[model samples]
Structure formats: structure tokens, C-alpha cells
Target: MTTPTHAHGHGHSHGHGIAPVSGRSLVTRLRSLMPLLGEHRRLIVVAYLAGVLHQLLLLTSSGIGAYVVARAAGGASLDQLTGWLIALGCLIVPLVVMSVADSTSAHVAAFRALADTRAKVFAAFERLSPGYMLERRSGDLGSAAVSDVEQIELFFAHTLSPLAVASTVPVATTVALCWFDWRLACVLVPVLLLLASVPAWLRRQAELHGHELRDSLGRMSADSTDTFQGLRELVNFGAHAQRLGLLRGQGARLAKAKSGHGRRGGIEYVATDTIALLGILAVLVLGARLVIAGDLDRSLFPVAVVLAAMAMLPVLKVTEVARELSMVASSADRITTLLDTPAPVSDLVSRAPAGPVVPHVRFDDVTFSYRGDQRPAVREVGFEIRPGETVALVGRSGAGKSTCANLLLRFWDVTAGSVSVGGHDVRDFPQEDLRRLMTLVPQDTFLFNTSLRDNIRLGRADASDDEVEAAARAAQAHEFIAALPEGYDTVAGELGALMSGGQRQRIAIARALLKDAPILVMDEAVSNLDAASEQAVGQAMEEARHGRTTLVIAHRLSTIRTADRIVVIVDGHVAETGTHEELLAAGGAYVELLASQLEGFVERAS
Candidate 1:
């Protein structure tokens, strides 16, 4: 049961700061997108073939114009010109048809690849430890899931086709020009390079700006979530104005960053325009010179210049799209890191075979600590709970009571020692099977924004409606639920905001009863209830504990007075273990805790 620690990648620091996700070089970023295409190999083949054919049709269109001008320059007949026009129509129609079909195929293949990649990303995270997941931000993780995978779509839909087309178009265009005259092809090559370089510079600036933008957006989302969750606190303290000012400041920073990138992007567009115009001018002047010198046919020169000029479309388009795609690739890297996160310890042990039910649990010399802390939360702690016994763990706030609850549930493994249930090491039990044997009513009860019946049914998804009501009755929640506007159908509204604390606690207890696990852990379930409600819930808890190995964590002395045994914990170790009267008579940690609560109880009663 030793909880393992993983060494993060070399650049990862142990400090309490968020580090940028690492391990993606330019090559890996490109490779990650390649797998998506490989996954749909057949579709990719068909799509690329369509793209190449589409480019060829375009090449043919340009060739038709070249033939028309060359024929006219040689003083050919009007009848021949009319025949050339008809051939031009044939080339133009296929050019349009194949281009449309190519786009359609790319889109279909891109979406299917995206779907497969998304499923794998989510599945990988699902296999990681819950403890590791809780440490990350919900908003940041949300951005990774929705926004990150979307970026890869550009790789399939646009990047792939443009790459294939750019490669073929320039090569084919260059060869045709070379056949006419090498000087024209030579002049055009440099122009394409200059135009492509402009966007590369723009993309470098964009990558830096994009990183800042993503960070600001993540902070904005985190702050927004915090504000909504703490609305009551903010209103009560009149802190809304200050929080709003902070949000506005972050928004302004993001806008400034975006506008700066936009300005640089405009400069890039102007650069591309200059390059294109220069290439056209060079081709025109050279073609005219060749015609006057009688080194080229007058009609062929115009047609050659036009064909060379059109070839810039795919090259220039690829450069521009590649720049925008770097931002998309940023999202891809973040998502890939999350999906690639390795589990700290591999679950290699096969599940113990299920046989006789053993309700007993034993912790032998257990030790545990949180991820970064130097001090252990629970150290050298050992105990045993026999079948059908009710044991209460009583402690001050940081005495590791909840840590013990987490240990029993196997939310994390111990740093050292063994924890076993029913004579099987907890680690040897399948996670799902181990969970099936235990149920918990946490200190802070959470009910989904759903009906009372549906909320209770979460304990056992397959439980019948009648079985649900029976469990509710046992938890003393049936009467109040029946009196509600819609009875069991009443909406709980975000974490049971529609119900009182006592009502939520009852619902949680009902869930535990419905689960009907042999081992139950109730952590301060009645702590927030008023005296009358506490009395009601405590009675329900007592009923629920019958014939089960129950472990209750309580702050209130009265709640554990009837517990078969009470263990007092102090500074991660059990200081005393005995009946309530025995511990009180012993006059140690229990005596001090009881005295503090007695004063509060007297004040409330008065």
C-alpha cells in the first residue's frame, strides 16, 4: 500500500506554481497531428488523391490559356481560336468540380479523426488517479477538452491538403515554365520564398502573444468560477466591486494582446501583396522582352505569365494558414500533455476473487502524506474494526480524521503499511469491487441539480423507484420529500440549494442506505444541523449503522456518546481509545474537547 511518487518531466518544478505543459517540440507537435490522419488512413488517401487531381485540373486550365495565346501570336485562324475556347471550358469545369469534391472529402475525414482523438484523450485521463486530477483547475482542464482538440481539426482539414497541393502545384508549375524558359521559373521561385518568410515572422510573434492570451483567459475563467461559487460571501462582504475591477483589468490585457497580434498580422498581409505584385511585374517585363527579341512567341508570353501568377495561391495560402495554425497547435499541446499524463503506480495486481463477505477492516502501521507536504497527515496509525461494530473517530480539525476516511476509500494508498478489508489487501481488490463494498456520507453533502429521487438513485443507478422511497423513509427524509411541491421530483438546484442542510444530510444518508454496502463511513454528517434536526439525523444514522462495520467521524460529543467505541486522535496519531465515559473519566484530549463543546452547548441552550 505504499503510495508512489512520480518524477515529472525534467523541466517540471516542485514549486506551487503552474508550469507550462512540456515535452512537445516542433517535430512532436507535427507528429501528434499525423496520427489522426493515420487513424483514418483510407479516408486520408482518398482525400489527398482528390486534392492532387484538383491541382492537376488547375494546371490544365493554365495550360489551355498558354496554348490560346501562343496560337493567336502565331496568327492562327479564328476557327482555331473558337476550338481552343471550347477546350478551355472543359478544363475550367473539372477544375471547379474537383476542387469542391476535395474540400468535401477533407471535411468528412477531419471530423471523424477529431472524434477518435477526443475519445482517446478523455479515456487516458479517466485512467489517472483521482487525487492527481483534483489538483488541476476545472476551467483550465475545460479549455483543454473543448478548445484543444478543436485546434487539431485545422491539421486535417486545411494543413494536410494545402501541404499536398503546395508541393505539387509549385513543382508542376515550375516544370512547365522551365520548358518555356528557365529564367521565368527562376524569377518566380525567390518571390514565393520572400512571401512565405513574411508569415513565418508573423507566426513567431503570434506564438508569444498567444501564450500570454491563453494564460490570461485561464485566469479569467478561474476567477469567474470562483466568483459565482462564492456569490453569497462576496455579497455579504461587499467585495463584488473589487472583484469586478480585477476581471475588467484582465479582460483589457487580453484585448491588448489580441490587438497587437492583429496589427502585426496586417503587416504580414501587405508583405504578401508586395511579393505577388513583384513576381507578376518580373514575369511580364521578361516575357515582353523575349517577344520583341523574337526568342518567344508573342501570344505564348502572356499565357505563360498568367499561369505562373496563379500558382502563388496555394503557396501563399499555406503560409498564411500555417501562421494561424500555430495558435491552434498551442491548444493541441496542452491537451496532449493532459491525455499523456502517466499514472503514478500501475495497477498490476489481479482482483481478489469474491467469496464470503468479510466486513472487518484492518490498518497496520499506516503512514500517509499529501503530494508536496513534508509532514505526514497520518503516521504509524494502526487499528482494526471488527464486523458489525460502530467506531467513532473524534478529533480536532487537522487531526487526520478525513484523511483516514480517504484512506479507507482508497482515494490514495498509504505511504507505508498495509490496509486490508475482509482479509484481502485493499490494493489486490479491483477498484470497482472495493468501492462496491463501501459507502460514504461526506461532511459536505453534494446533491446534483436534479430531482430528489434521481439524486438518491445515484447510490445505485439500477435501483427501482419503490426501493428509493424505502431508503428515504429509513433516513427519515420521506415525510419532508412528500410535502415538497413535486415530492420526489423536486429539483435540488446546484448542490441542494433548494433544501436545508439537514434535508441534504438526510438525502445523503438515504443514498448510503440504498447502496447497502457492508462498510459505511459518515464524516460529520450531522455537524451543521440544528439541535432538533441533529437529533433526527443522529437517530437515522444509528438505524443505518445496524449490523454494518460503521466508522463515524464526529465533532459533536453528543453524536458519538452512543458509539460502541470512540478513538481520540491528535496530531495524526490516536491519543486515546475507549468508551465516551472512559475517555472523559481519563481526562486527556477527549476531556479538553468535550469541555470546549460543553461551553458552546450551554451558550446555545441559554
Candidate 2:
């Protein structure tokens, strides 16, 4: 009703229209989060240190166990055995303290950081152009806002501290092993090195499958959202099987991507387990040889083998965690890409006068196109609506009717030329300042899932109950609202209100009337109504237009018969303009359209 989705096309399916965007590095993606994470940076650092220290304590406790074994095997005194055993138990309290500190700090910082990131993402969406939101799939965007952010949480909560510990604790343990017998450290070093190499060797594969998994997941979510939102339509048309088939297609793609990602992870998991096992075996053989050759004390042989395994333990954990980073990295890529999406680039001038204002609206050779569209939706077309006049715009569907209203409201900037209000370019006013002077009643009204009273109040938040009721009465929405169970307070929206199409139109008209803006743009407001309701609401609309500049985007000729002037648009350009009788007398594009409608009417009657 506002311009069709495009000037030429009817609509697009969910998964087919996802535009390609440049991928970003994980570190580069993380830079957007620096401001949000700055608050908790200290806590994150503390968490890392706590995790490493806890791991060190565990390794130390293991070493004490090995030391007690060696002393017992050497036939040490009972007091010596008791002292070493007691040392291991003393390590317990600090271990408990460090574990609690690590888990608490990591999760607290991670959750708070995630909360901040989610808010920023929503805020970015708020600041973007309304047109941008309409162009994207709601479900795909929802996945980014909800699911993608959830994936990033894995890195901070479960993976991050472990990654830090892997980097640090293994090196500390390896140094300790070197002190025991440098030969033991030698065998563990190659195992740690090989396990660490797994991630780097498969880096390309990780990135490839990560993107696949994320993209397919978004596609499936979008398909599901589209299906659910249009479930009623699908069922009414008896197309349930068709919708199910599309959903299955989306599911199949997602499954394929998941399988690829899992296969990559499996490789990393196998490499880690294999390398660790080999290191343990090699240490056992070497330690046995050293004891037999009498080059090492028999009591220290088993201790050295245990130390060799402990040193390689952290590296094995590192590789295990690395496998999951594929998802985290991909999620980060999507989020940052969203943040980087360019908002409509423009400058709004502050020179326009403030306060309640609506002047003559003029389009001076206005040319515009939606992003990604080749040809302009409206091109080099000019028109004017003088203050306090009622003008009707009539055209075949997709003739840029609603686009004109979008321009006046500054939902988008013109590609070339200018649209002006009060003889100043529309961009001369801040978006908020410009929108305050006009109201657009779209064909499809979106009501929030809230009370009916609250929905009406959205037009003018400060309007009183009396004023609201007056507006509702003017739009003829009052009678039906009063008949409802809760009257004006009845809950309304997706599942609430149980409203008819005509009834919803009346509510929208009421909302526009409440705003009381000086300029009103109504797009087929009465199109959904039956003849009886249409006549009543038409009278209300007629009265509402008095003393205001009104632009009616009409498809039905009967609706605009009372309009003072009519402008005929053809393929985004104005073809004719005059009073209804004057246009009919001219016998131009207007007459051709009128004749076609008359022929259709006669056919329907027959």
C-alpha cells in the first residue's frame, strides 16, 4: 500500500533474498564490544588469573600424591609419609576458594557483558531506517539479536577461562616437569605442540563450516518465523503441505551445515586424544628404561610419568575448546556485520523553524530508489499539495503511491532532487521534528500486543482518556470497542481483540486522528470495510480532513469521488492532475483507468 516492496515486484520469499555482506575477522568483530566490555574488563582478567591458579593448585596436589608414593616405596618413616599426605590435604581449601572465585567471576562478567551487547544491538536496530528493517527478513534479524548473541556467551562463560588456563597452566606444569628430569619434559613438549597445531592446521575449514552453519541456521529460523506468522493464510488457502515442504527444505540445509561443522570438530577431538595417549605411553617406556639403567632413582620413575601426563593435560583441553570456537567466531562475524550495516547516510539541517507547522508540500523532480533496486521507484516526478487542501493520488498497484507518503514523512531520503515542507528541503528538519507534523495511516496497521487503550495512546502519549474517546468516536471505532468485554481496556494485538479487517482500519484511523498532526496521509483506509462501514468511516475521514492538508492514496475510484483534486500516477510519474470531472473530461490516462474499472464492475454484476 505504501509503495509495493519494490516498484516492480510483488514480494520475496524469506531465504532467497538474504543479501551477501563482507565477512569480518573475529578480533575485528570483537572491537565493537570493547566499549561494553570495558566495564567488566577487570573482572574478566581476574577470572582468567583465578582459573589458571586453580589449575596450578590441582597439578601441585597431584605432584604431592606422586611424592608420597615415592617416599613410601623408599621405605620412609611413618612421620615422613604423614607430612607429605597432610601437605596434599592443605591444598584443598585454596583449591575450593580458587574454583569458586573462577566460576563466579567468569559467569558474572560474561552474563553482564552479554546483556550490554544485546541492548546495543537492539539500539542499533532502533537507529536504522524503517525502510532497512522492512527490507530484511524479521526472523533472520531475530536470530542475530537472540540466537547469535547466545552463542557468544559460550566463549565468555565456558570457553574463555579455560582458554586462558590452557595458555598458562600447561607452561607452568611443563617447567616443573623439566626440574624433575628434563627427559620427561621432552616427551610432553611434542605432544603439547602437536595438539596446539590442530586448530591452526584446520583454521580454514573451521571458518568455512562456521559460516555455513550460521547462515543455514538463520535461514531456517527465518522460514519458521514466516510460516508461523502466515499460518492462518496458509491454512485458509489449503496450502499447509506447501508450507511444510518449504520448512523441510530449510531444515535439510541446516542439517547439512551442522554435519560439516561436526566433522571438523571430530578431527580436532581425535587429534587431541591421540597425541595425549601417545605422550603418556612414551613417558612410561622412557621412565622404565631410566630406572633399569640405574641412571634415575627407582622411586622417582613413576613420579616422572605422572608429571608428563599432567603437563599435556591442559593442551588437550585447549584443543577440545578450540573445536567449539567455530560457532563463537561465526556468531561474532554476524553480529559485527549487523553493527557495521550503514544507516541511511544523510545530514539533517537545523535551520528549519520549530513548533506546530505544516506548509505546502512539494516534490521538485524527486527521484528515489530502494537500496539494491536497479531502477528508481519514483523518478523525476514533481507535485505539490498546498496547505489546507485535500489531494488524492490514484494509480494501479506498485505505482509509487505509498512511496510519496514515505518521502513526506522522511522515512528515506531522495536519491536525487528534493522533497520540501514549508519551502525548505525535508532534510532541513531533524527526523523527530519532521515526523511530528504528519501522520501516516498505512493499509496494514500494526498493533502492539497490549491493551486497546494503550494502542490508541501511542499516537499521542499525553492525550487524555476523554480526548482519546473523542478521536475514536470520530473514526467510528468507539461503537465496536464499547461492545467488547473490557471496552477500551480490552487487550489487543496478534491474538487479542479478535478484530475484523474493517475494525482494525477504524482503530488506525482513530490513532491518526488522536495524533492531530497538521498533515495526514491515508493509504486506502476504507478499502477493507464493507459498504455500510465504508460509508460511515468515509464521512469520519472527510470530517477529519477539514482544516488539514490531506493526501489520500486511493485505488478505488469511488473512495476519492469527493476529493477536491485527483492526481493520476503511471509508472512512478505523474500523468494527469485535476478535479475528478476535469480528469474524466480530459480523456487521458485517468479516463482509461476509469473505463477499465467500470467494465470490471459490470462483469461482477453479470
* lDDT at residue 141 of model 2 (Cα atoms): 86
Top-scoring candidate (TM-score)? 2
lDDT of 1 by residue, 352-395 (tens): 55687598988888887776667788888887788999889988
TM-scores, all candidates, are 0.90, 0.90
- The C-alpha stretches of model 2 lying farther than 4 A from their native spots are 1-36, 295-303, 345-356, 372-374, 462-464, 493-497
lDDT of each: 0.78, 0.78
- Over 136-245, each residue of candidate 2 has an lDDT whose tens digit, in order, gives 77888888889888888777777667777888877886787677678877887887788778887787788778777888888888889888878889999999999999
Compute the lDDT for candidate 1. 0.78
Error of 1 at 531 (Å): 2.8
Model 2 lDDT at residue 545 = 86
User: After aligning candidate 2 to the native by TM-score, how far in Å is the CA of 512 from where it should be?
Assistant: 1.7
Which residue pairs in model 1 clash with each other? 69-299
